[model samples]
Target: MTHIELSVLIPAHNEAGNLPALLDEIALALSGITPVITPVINYEVLVMDDGSSDDTWSLLVQRAQHDKHLRPLRHSHSAGQSTSVWQAAQLARGTWLATLDGDGQNDPADIPALMQAAIDEDAVLVGGHRVVRQDTKLKLLSSRIANNIRRRLLDDDSPDSGCGIKVIRRDAFLSLPYFDHMHRFLPALIHAQGGKCLARPVNHRERGTGQSHYGLGNRLWVGIVDLMGVMWLKRRSRLPALVTGIEDSELLRGESEAVTQAHEESVAAHVVSSRMEALKG
Candidate 1:
């Protein structure tokens, strides 16, 4: 099988009514962009049904049968959105991964733009900033408060962390430590690994079906705790060392002691230089 260039993972929870429309929208969005592969742009859409009580899994199965690009994975029990995303990433064969909520609030049309931004910035993570969030007043307020607190604490500069539409490199994402609500800390996490993160404005829409799974109180209270966890992670992050020198080895045991001493001196000098530069910085 050919490797997919992009894997779009949508985590669904009781979203049977929204799956068909979401799939159609994604099809339309992907139709315009040329994939990394020629003739057939190698792309796949994986919908993870997180133990939805509704007919969401059935709908996904039906879609997958007709559409080769559509693949469905299911959890036996309800897993949070972060867990669902992690599960999809494990199954994905794409070099790049795009994620969106399955509630139909995130517009698929914005996906191409996010992909473009990722390319332009050479970013490992490209987050969507909702231009006009079509959510309830309470939801908007809660998100604003959360974003503000997160920006201040993490200094990630992302305007809208809650936006569900995002594009990220698979390897970079996989390298980051996983947590329950890691999705909300992508910008900070990516930056901690020396990866660039760019945020671009995208379209957001009101839900056409089923009520939102999140609410203001849960977001404000639960999100505060998650933010604190992210801060602790940031403090513990450290930059990797770049090895500058190696000691030469003599193959012959009969080699003069002077030769070994010279090599050892050279290695010590290199280590001292590296330490000096690090101290200077």
Candidate 2:
């Protein structure tokens, strides 16, 4: 069995028109990556079709037949983007997960950079900051207001929390508390878990096809309630005390090297064990 290092997850709803090119771009962006940046470059693209009425799921099915890395998941009824991503994360077979917006505004070309940043900075989550946003005046204004309000309240230090491009450790992400709109508060949630998160500048493009799934109502009003919930969660968070004077104490040095090595070895061993179990079956 091949070991996967990264899983690029796309939580899409009615995004058939945008996925073909987006998938190609993800393939191209990931192809150039080598082990120099990470322990392994093997990756998968997991697209979650959240009950789209269009050809999204069919397109993924056809693409996955030809593209070995493409993995498609679906929902019979429309679950929100957060639900799509949460479900996909549980099924991901990679050590790391990179999320991209299905709308194509979040550039696939920036993924490698974000992945690299996550490694370099020792961050569990690396969020993309769209320095120059390409949206209408209304969207820009609404996003700005929302972002500012969230920053003041949550203080997650993310410049663009709405930017749908981020690289996160799969284990770390799974450890976070699940909620309806948890995707919007990733940085804060990571912080609540005593994990580090970094923000890096990334490219953002105008939507070429299909309508955006978000608007002021969903993006702002609903988010306000979610923000309060996250704040409550953060206040209640309590990290485990670090143990010392033992073999695991070695991990306390150098960005938790011992811990990372143990995790990698565990994942590899699990893969081999699964393969052996399959043979037995």
Each model's lDDT? 0.77, 0.78
Best by lDDT: 2
| Tens-place lDDT digits, model 1, residues 1-281 | 55567889999999998989999998877875553323344678989888799999888888778998997887776767887787688667777799999999999877777877888777888899988889899988888889888888888787887788999987777777666667888888888777788999888888979999899667887888778777766675574422222322221111221113344345346545643543443
In terms of TM-score, how similar is model 2 to the real structure?
A: 0.83
lDDT string, candidate 2, 241-273, tens digits:
222233332221122211133443454465456
TM-score of 1: 0.82
In model 1, which runs have C-alpha deviations exceeding 4 angstroms?
A: 33-40, 239-281
Clashing pairs in 1: none
Which portions of model 2 show Cα errors greater than 4 Å? 33-40, 239-281
